[model samples]
Target chain A: AQSVAQPEDQVNVAEGNPLTVKCTYSVSGNPYLFWYVQYPNRGLQFLLKYITGDNLVKGSYGFEAEFNKSQTSFHLKKPSALVSDSALYFCAVLSSSASKIIFGSGTRLSIRP
Target chain B: SQTIHQWPATLVQPVGSPLSLECTVEGTSNPNLYWYRQAAGRGLQLLFYSVGIGQISSEVPQNLSASRPQDRQFILSSKKLLLSDSGFYLCATRGDPGTRGYTFGSGTRLTVV
Candidate 1:
């Protein structure tokens, strides 16, 4: 079974500081990883995805994620956090042969101004 | 550009009332459709997926059911509602491998009392 784990339930960061939301995965083969963000009472918006190529993948809204094959981790990162960037983040995984995508427990990101 | 629409934006129902949430996609064809639910402060739980019309695969056993009567139409229904079923329901669609990523609807907030 393919699964994703988001270790932190919440992450707090001061504005202008860097922020990280940790994510790890378990899959039988190479994984297609994606990160999504959700604002209050809204649907999730796609931020980025990692299919192949460079480990560092940049995404929408000045966000990026690094896919670490050795550590089986795909952590979301931002160089500078903004108060408006605070939202719920989810990490998801899907193998090429898999018909469905599995999502991890979400992490609530809070940026204090 | 592809767009997904889900409604009603907000719904309040009694414990035993019937429930139905509809989703439709535009500017695409033969897309893979999915239904997901998010409880308070939790990640997305995939409920059902459809590869084509009248083809639905359920991921979990619950009070909800889904239907794909048309290529761009997906509907989630329940014979009777439960308080536990109250949450935000989201619909998503993705094209074949060439598509960039999944597109999500605005979401429907259901509150069962």
Candidate 2:
């Protein structure tokens, strides 16, 4: 079974500073990775995905994630985070043979001023 | 332009009550649909998925069930709701083969009273 691990339970960053949320995946063959954000009572919104080429994938709200095959990691990053960027973040992975996307334990991002 | 919608946005039910959460997709055909649940401040747990009409695959064995009666519609139901079933329910759709991440719906927040 394919699975994703978000080692960090929470990440605190200063506003206007760079931020990162770490993610690693375990799977057979190739893996498709994704990042999503969820607010208070809303559902998750898609941020980015890595299916094929370009190890560095860009996503919404000025977020980007790097897919490292050797490390089995797809870390989400942002050059500068806004106060409003603080939310719950999740890392997910999917296999070709799997119909459902497996999600991580989630990382709560807190942007401090 | 594919869009997904889920309702009602928030529901409060008593224990042992029945549930019928509806999800529908527009502007997409034969899309893969998924249902996921997230506890407060936790990651998502895949509940079920569908490849086509009347085709459902359950990821976890629980009190919940899902059905895809229409090509672009999916419903999550349960005969008797439990207190453990209170959470945020999300519906999503993937566009093509080899694609994993998805377009998500607005989610339904269910609180078992």
Candidate 3:
């Protein structure tokens, strides 16, 4: 089965510093990877995705993710963390030949100001 | 531009009550719709997805039932809501299934008392 793994349950980062949340996926064929964020009492918001082309894909809220096919990893990254960046983050992989998006266990990101 | 909307931003219902949650998409057609639930401090669990009207695929078997009466409208219902159903409910859609990413609605917070 296709699945995703988030190595960390929580990540703490100081404001103005770079942040990374690790993710790894397992799939049969090439994978379509994604990252999403959810704030308190809000629905999930799309952050970024990797379909093809460049390994590094940039997304909303100054966020980006690197899709490493060899390592089967797609980790979310940000150049500079902000206090407002604290939220729940999820990594997903579309597994089926049809369309099936499977999400990983979420990671809570806390940006200490 | 495309947007997704979910109704009843917050709902507190007693156990054994009938429940209904709605999701609608605007500015798009033939969308692939999805329903998901999240418990507090956890990741998402996909409940159902639809590729077209009157077609629903369930990811997990539970008390929840879903219906898609129109191309861009999806509804999740339960005859008798369980306390375990208390959580955040989210709806999402994609223009096409395999190639595109999903856009999510604002979400509905259901608190079963």
Cα deviation of B34, candidate 1, in Å:
0.8
Tens digits of lDDT, candidate 2, A54-104: 999998999999999999999999999899999999998888777667889
Docking class of 1: medium
The DockQ of predicted model 2 stands at 0.64
TM-score of each: 0.96, 0.94, 0.94
TM-score of chain A of each: 0.99, 0.98, 0.97
How do all the candidates rank in terms of DockQ, highest first?
A: 1, 2, 3
- The per-model lDDT (C-alpha) reads 0.92, 0.91, 0.91
Q: Which of 1 and 2 is ahead in TM-score?
A: 1
Give model 3's TM-score versus the native structure.
Answer: 0.94
Global lDDT for candidate 1? 0.92
lDDT of 1 by residue, A4-112 (tens): 9999999999999999999999998889899999999998888999999999999999999999999999999999999999999999888887877888999999999
The prediction achieving the highest DockQ against the true structure is 1
Instruction: Give the per-residue lDDT of model 1 (tens digit) for B1-74.
Output: 88999999999999999999999999999989999999995888889999999999998999999999999999
Best lDDT among the predictions, by candidate number? 1
Q: Runs in model 3 with CA error above 4 Å?
A: B97-100
By summed lDDT, which 10 consecutive residues of candidate 1 chain A come out lowest? A94-103
Q: Model 1 segments beyond 4 Å from truth?
A: none
Instruction: List native contact recovery per candidate, as a fraction of 1.
Output: 0.62, 0.70, 0.65
Candidate 3 clashes between residue pairs 3 or more apart in a chain or in different chains: none
